[model samples]
Target chain A: MIEDRPLIYKYLRHDKKFPHVWCGGCGIGILLGSLIRAIDHLGYTKDEVVLVSGIGCSGRLPVYVDFNTLHTTHGRALTFATGVKLAKPELKVIIIMGDGDATAIGGNHFIHAARRNLDLTAIIVNNNIYGMTGGQYSPTTPYGQRATTAVYGSVEHSFNIAQLAVCAGAVFAARGTVYHVRQLDGLIEKALLKNGFSVVEVISQCHTHYGRLNKLGNQIDMMKQQRDSAVPVEKARKMSPEEMEGKFEIGILVDREAPNYLEQYNKVRQKAKNALSLQLTKEEKEESERREALDKQ
Target chain B: MHRRKKPEPKAQLMQGNEACAEGALIAGCRFFAGYPITPASEIAEHLSYRLPQVDGTFIQMEDEIASMGAVIGGSLAGVKSMTATSGPGFSLMQENLGFACMAEVPCVVVNVMRGGPSTGLPTNPSQGDVMQARWGTHGDHPIIVLSPSSVMECFTLTVKAFNYSEKYRTPVIFLMDEVVAHMREKVVLPEPNEVTVIDRVKPSVPPEWYLPYEDTSFGVPPMGIFGEGYRYHVTGLVHDIRGFPTLRQDEIEPFLLRLFRKISIHFADIQLVESFHTEDADLVIVAYGCTFRSAHRAMVEARARGLKVGLLKLITIWPFPRRVVEPLTRAKKTLLVPEMNMGQISREVKRVNQGMTTVLTVNKIDGTMITPQEILEKIEEEKK
Candidate 1:
């Protein structure tokens, strides 16, 4: 078999200490599968891409696929990813994280990176609950779910992932869930190919933790809820919020062209080139040497 | 003695911070990001004036983390880069320093250490961060930190810091005191041609074969330009040498051990020191940074009084120079440690002693330098 062709639906054999502590039938694997397919479709040589993640179930993504991996502090993956993008604009930089890791702990960085339109893709495997640290309530946990922190039904309204991305100035934003996994993979491919901050928020399952805690029914039932809940963004515009409440939005939310961060920062560099040329002239050299001798004495 | 060369003229009287900024430029630093904080503010102020002269970018970031972040980013872009701050701001930069370590990004961080835990004596002299420079970020990572004892050392070490940062693919600490940061010492900077500049290792292979974390023959991977044809990933994860994230027990174990041993294997080359009056010495005193000034005076005075005493001042603090201190501690009957902080280096001195000799500490945490009289007094007490 050609090594370049990725066999879809095959178990990923990469990260050893990983898929750690996530409950059975967790949606992380599904999102991870889509990410692999997207990269496969893009034909990114594994060595040429860099994946950065912060702490949390989703943030643990850097562990799985063999790319240049960075697992930093919570909510800090984007900041580090920005460094990677700014440093090496040729690198295929991507960041993967969970709901709380991105919108919660990493909210400020997320917005700022979006505003800058950095040349990187952000795939938020938002499974709703904080699955890594014992099923705690996350920023994206639905308003009516029960979590460790929110022992009673949650009162805080959930953030609409696509809307948040748009408001944050994301050039490419979209939503996909585990049930619509194949389309999710396609969205990731599109985001990876696009310039600037592209966000694909995959609505995933958390059967062992989130589903069990909130009494959101069995794994199959939770899967059905996600499938039934999403409405297409174009259709949602026509339908009322009431009609869109229980429907999933399955395609691109915001896709447009914008100047990426490194290209813009390079403008300052171009301007600096002239100043450097003048500073390094021969006359300036003799002057600096004479100054050095006097200072030494 | 060799014939004296003609004395060249002093172009301008620049502050130490100005010299540091100029030195960074001559060393090819094209990116400088910093936030204005006490004592070290002149560094940011100077960079603002000098970076424009060389067409380099000077950004006043929101805080120290972002400043250090930008420096690391800039270095990855194949630009020499640095950030400067006092202790308070240095604390804020600890997290990113760890990021630089885990990802092996090269950059310089000039920490003009002042007295305190949280905003302590921002304008005063204190060597409180000598230990923090080695062990600040949480983890068992090996670090190389160079301490600049004089204003001239500050300028020279700032350049050296950038060189080491680029060469080793690690963050090099320029641990300066407030006194050194603010002091106006005449610094004669070399012309850009006279000084050697080291750039980050660029990938030599075609973009397809180049992994950003794949170490070239130099034991450090050649970094890729972000916008170029290279398409490798870089992560802070314990990855295979190829630069991707991994969780194979095979991957994690080796990744961690390599992360630590890479520098440890090269410890001797990373060590730096200035030793004096150590031969035939009956008593030896160890110190570093600003305290070396007073320690020098005490070492001279003790010898003048017909007592055998000497000084071992460490310039490269991390890799700790235990080899240098260990022999002296065993050979000399008595050894004393004097520093501006409360017994930080003194603790290390005793640790290396292992009961072969008596190791004592002379600490002063009152935001003042430990005077020669104080160190001499300790030597005098040891004499009896």
Candidate 2:
């Protein structure tokens, strides 16, 4: 409630629970600022927006926002968002989840939601490790990276979330890192405005767990790595595959137009209604003809 | 193509699952999310075609968990929502069921009872889920579970299920077995105005003053719809009156107590039992779901042979209807409990009876329903 604060503060909960639960210098906090700024820039009423999140450091984001918020179970934010969007299609719903939440326990819902192409925005924070429950490896953890469960380094490869969404039929898919705040805001704003399933994979830092275990220094060092190794999609396409082996692509990877669930269902409703009316008219005509025949008799 | 709404035919031969879908429509439920499962799939199938005609939305989700999740989401967005599944799918829905309980989301989950430890009998009937329906979720949360024995009760009780769910702001379980779910019978569909439908109370206060979980004299607070300017936070975690997650013991204790107390205080309204010929009978048969039909038939056969027998059919399964059952134990000398499961509800009867009367049970667990002959034999054995 302090005056002279940033306009983004208008979207934050001013009553209580001031300091957030995310670790100091956590990339999740940075992403929160970007999300607020993006929503503010879009000029949507707080009442017309719903922020849903799943269990993780990111799940706590909704409680701090002034908009209608729901903190759902682990990995199930998108499913809930689907219901909300279908029921109240006018509302803009943005879902937030960690790497494990979106691709691990909730992986089935994620891919299916994209395939269904519901108009929802999914913001996934890929911290490479489970930060809330300590230093456990996540589905987006780098191959051969150290975690609490991976004392000898991980053997499984990581999921490129943006590419997964694109393959799963999302109309809009983009990747950004916390180091590129301006670009992250733009990606989020675009995803929010997309008319079909949209996704923004945020490569973030978890210095307390993933970074500490993997010897990635502090939050600044991890952010510096994101800036150095990340390549724009256009630039990466021109470079040789061997030259960009360890680097990741950033920027809009896919943008296309398709009918969202609500738009398709509206047509389904109209068709079903037309069929019913036709059936009713046929029945009514048969009844009238039978009555006239009876009168002639 | 706008046209006048027409009332359905007064009398028709309908399957139990078909009746449930009709009941949901008449009861003001506009959102349905479910997966295809045996015995229960017909409910979803019927709704998928019926909902769009009424401008309602029906979604076939990837699994039961997401179906339950979506139903909750729809309910939170100010729509009446529901899902239907059988045992295996119901097992997958337990966690989300608990979430609905904690979040106080009003939705109906129809679990068509099939034999199961793990996909035991998909096409057959069993009352084994009686206990699971009561305590399937992993918490001490309160729930309202209703069962239907015939096609007519399938329609009427489903309407009642939605009423209680909306009034209590809690999930209600419509427990229908395969026998009753598939059985076809003549039911008189009520006119639009005949059946009473209850909607959740909307917040009367302004948006700024709305507290989602504020404790009131009745322990049930008003609900505000999402995206309607009443911005609030909802979570599965234990939350305070403001609906924000709380770790303080003071807020947690009050929140849990109010949830339980809201249902407990309204036990008389929540409990529904059908009594037949119990006034002058010395022995009574307690049954539910499809098994109630056998118990009723057995009672008539026993009465023809000059044995005084009565039937007490439980329409509301959870909260146990202890008041109704306890009084019968005091008056009746012998109580015969016959069900498809070993002894799920009989144990509840014994706990309430407290050895006041002999509680004899006829258990059957081979994926077939208990027969009237078996129940009559148990009654005859008690006489001998």
Candidate 3:
């Protein structure tokens, strides 16, 4: 018999944390595999990778990875990652957060982190609903989708997270689905190599809570739903407004460059140091004036 | 060759907030994240100007919550980090402060208290957040809180706060009143060598054998920073010795107790109390923060008038300095607490008193300082 272990196994904590908290057949595992493969492909050492997560099913992903992992409070992963990236610009800090954790509770940090444009990778797992909290409605849950909190279907509209990231000044914003495993891996890898704040919103499925509450069949059915509904950005651009209803683009939505936070802060430090060197005391100022007068004479 | 004369060491007039910013730099704090609020904003503003000059990073966060989160993150990344806020902002920081305690991240939080249950007064001074600093964060966790009475103490105590945070792998609260935060006084700061600056202990063992939260002979475990090849996990959840979240009761019980015991066992070094004429006195006033300044004045005048009055100024607020305070409760006839809040720290003084002595409280919630004359009058009444 031939061995069939995956290449990404090198990045996993094999000695401990077996049987992760993610439910069986959940999309989180698929996205986690995509992340691991992306990191493995990038060839960055585990010592240089810092995986930061907020409190949720997605937050639990960092513990399984053999990296410098930090599982912070709900919705504050980006803020903590900001500190890490600012303190040590050499470390590659990757932040993971759930839909509700990212959009609702941590919305301010999410947008601000994008606006700050720190050199950090934010992988937002958009599972539509708060799965760990028993299928409660999240900011990304589609309108008219039934949730545990919204038994009669949600009235509020959902956010287009990739578009929001672009509007919030992220240098690179992309959307990929768990069904598109290869595409997610590429998107995450590209995001990891991006110069500024990069976001890869993974449209994943919470089969146990979200699927059961909305009568969306089972895990495989939801994965098939993701495959059917996702339109490529190239196709999205060519399609008419009327033909693009109930569809989201599944590729890089925005990719551009701006001066990232650390680069700008370096300039500020240089300016401050220059100013300090140029500054003179009262006696020095008086002596310089007297010397100038003497030279004129 | 004409050489210039070296500038003489001199005392300069500096604001309390300015002293705190200077103190942080001297204590090796390289990262600061804060949001602007009244009184405490000066600390952020001064650090914003000073940090970049020292090749340090200073960030103005969206709110106090993000500021605190960033502070903890910077600390975990092997840098001394801090954030400053007032009462309303401090309220926002409680959740993240609790997270820091649970994760044992070393950082400093300075709360320059303004009058408030909800933004009651922005510019006025109040010693109201004393109790909140101890219990604001959810869950039972150990915290070191230092209150400074003067501008010089503000500089010294801010350095002390960073040392305590790093030594214990815990968050230390630097509690200041609006009065102390804004008051300008002549202060000569000590050289870096004069004050002891401590850093967190790192693991001596290799990454394969390192446990981030291992129960050691000393309660505090060596802290490993991120990206140091340790590759350890850090979580806000009740975690085991390996820093991974565990549901086992055996790991959970010791984890909680160690958080408290780490600070408690080192109470001898943690407790800081200043006494003024306490020996051979019938009456003693227990005060802290800016109120201690007034009580000190009252004690001086009372002694001049032949009244045996003493003042115990509590510098360390959190562990309550029970060892020193409990003794005063039994030996002294009266323990007076004059504060700018409605008996916040006085309640602790009473609890430790346990009905052993008369605990008199003069609380002013009208956004005014407790005057020395008011305390002197109280002492006179006690004498009669």
Candidate 4:
């Protein structure tokens, strides 16, 4: 099964650089591998691409990837990526980071980026814990989950990312867990190919810290929990509220056609250009040309 | 056949902040995100009108946070980007500032120094952010900050801000004072070709073997754009060369050192300052931001009377031109530090001087600049 990702083997320049930033038994590598697989399947030429990241343990993802990359400031990867996107609309912009990065600290950007529906794919690796800053409870940390700040269990309600993205006008939204590696890759690939804002919320695990505190213990056990708890979006949609309780959906939750923010923005721009051009008439333009011709003599 | 060389674009009297905006455009900055703030608002105002003219994007965000967010987002998308704000708003940008350092995003932030620990002065000049600009965030970090003393310098350095930001892959802070940001002056805008520009490094290696964190021959690694064919992960975590989240005991130290060294290696380009009349002067006046303009006037006054007084104007505030000050400490008998705030640059002066030179401070907190008369009086008082 690992051979399924010889694509990963070919990409691995130095196996020494790996074991990567993920903790022992961490699920981030699973999703990280899936991300690589999706890129390989799409056969993107790595040179022209740029990956921008916000702060958090997850933001570290870009440092490892070999390409034009940026590990941006906290919660500001979207802003930086937005700049890169607008500067060279020819380049592909990817924003990857943890829950703390994409949500709490970067929440304002997260909502606005979706609202604008910019042509970017934001892959949020929701490890629930702010691993880099120490396992602090983030906006996506489940209610009653024990984290560093939420040692007594989080009293705050967790956000449903897929629904929030949908409300924010993202053209595509999906949820995945490391347990569903293949499905996660497919969703990421689709999100990458999509023309507008696309978000794939990958539920990840931090075994060393998040697991110990929550009593989820060990890397492999955490992976199983995610597997058992995830209900397909379709299955959950058809199920009763009682049946849906305690089950997370893993699949493309909402995918639809929408005008990208750039196109809409460009339209406003095109209108201004046309108006300016029209203000100069064909008769006057031709007369001006004839005058220039006469002056040439 | 007499040919007129298309009237060399006439110079215009422009606001300092407006010149900064024009400078940004000339530097190839195609994305601007900023919320209007007094003094600095002219920058956003100018950008709003001009960005579209050149096919660039300008977004006025709800607040300074979103403005920085949008700026960072746009930059990562492969655009040269910037956002401008004064003290209060600059404080709001600190968290993201830390993020910018951790994530290694190249960008430019203009802090038109107003009064503050918090909302101190909206329209006044203060060098108070002198320390805040360096250690504002919560961590061990290295930052590149450039302070401009005049309207023309504001234009020139703002463009340099973008170049250094992209080259270093760090958010370069353009520290201009309220006076500098608002003061109007005649500026000759440079042609695009005449101005030096730096685009981010393209991927020199294949994507498969790419480690976004892998140190390049230049210390900084190549940056891959997001939507292009290459795909990689980026995080703010203390990780290994792979750029993934790591908890290795050995990772934190080297990671930070390299982060610090990346900028430190290019200190020559980063640390910029100018010394006028320092050659045989008995006294040296240390200043930056809007205060430098006043110091320049004071230098002329002192020199007219043959007071042997010199002025050391700081152009790059961050890697604090140590050599410039170190020599000044040994060569000069006294240093007069005049600033809008109680004493910011004064402390830096004292630190480098090692008490060898008496560091005099002409502190102003009345929401006004230290005048030439005030600085001259302070310099003469040091004589007695």
Q: Could you estimate the TM-score for every candidate?
A: 0.81, 0.97, 0.97, 0.81
Q: Model 2: per-residue lDDT, tens digit, B1-384? A: 334334356588999999999999999999999999998999999999889999899999999999999999999999999999999999999998999899899999999999988989989999999999999999798999999999999999999999999999999999999999999999998976999999999898988899999998887889899988789999999998888888999999999999999999999999999999988888999999999999999999999999999899999999899999999988756788898998999999999999899999999999998999999988898888
Complex DockQ, candidate 1:
0.22
- Candidate 2 regions exceeding 4 Å error are A1-5, A286-297, B1-9
- What level of docking quality does candidate 1 show? incorrect
lDDT of 4 by residue, B1-384 (tens): 533334456598988898899999999988888888876899998887777766888887767877876776676666788999988899888877777787788889998888776767787777788889999888999999999877889889988898888888999999888888888888888777888888888677776676767765577877765665456655566767766657777877878888898998889888888889888888888888888888999999999977989988889989888878888888755888888777777878888989676778889888787889998987777776
- lDDT per residue, candidate 4, A1-297, as tens digits? 658556766655343455566566677667768888888888876665676776666766666655566776667778767766766777777788788888787788889889888899999998778887778888888889999898899999888887888888899999999888889989999999999999999998888778888998787888888999999988888989898787788899899998887888787667656755666677578867766766676
Looking at model 2, the pairs that clash are none
Q: In candidate 3, what are the lDDT values of residues B1-384, reduced to their tens digit?
A: 555555456699999999999999999999999999998999999999999999899999999899999999999999999999999899999999999999999999999999988988999999889989999999888899999999999999999999999999999999999999999999988877888899889988999999989998889999998888888999999999998889999999999999999999999999999888777888989999999989999999999999999889999999889898888888856899999888988899899999899999898988989999999999999899
- Across A6-57, the per-residue lDDT of candidate 1 in tens digits comes to 5532324342444454556778867777788788777887657777777877
Report the C-alpha displacement of residue A106, candidate 4, in angstroms.
Answer: 2.8
Best by DockQ: 3
Better of 2 and 3 by lDDT: 2
Whole-model Cα lDDT of every candidate shown, in order: 0.77, 0.92, 0.92, 0.81
List RMSD in Å for every model shown: 5.6, 3.1, 2.9, 5.1
- C-alpha lDDT of residue B116 in model 1: 97
By lDDT: ranked, best first: 2, 3, 4, 1
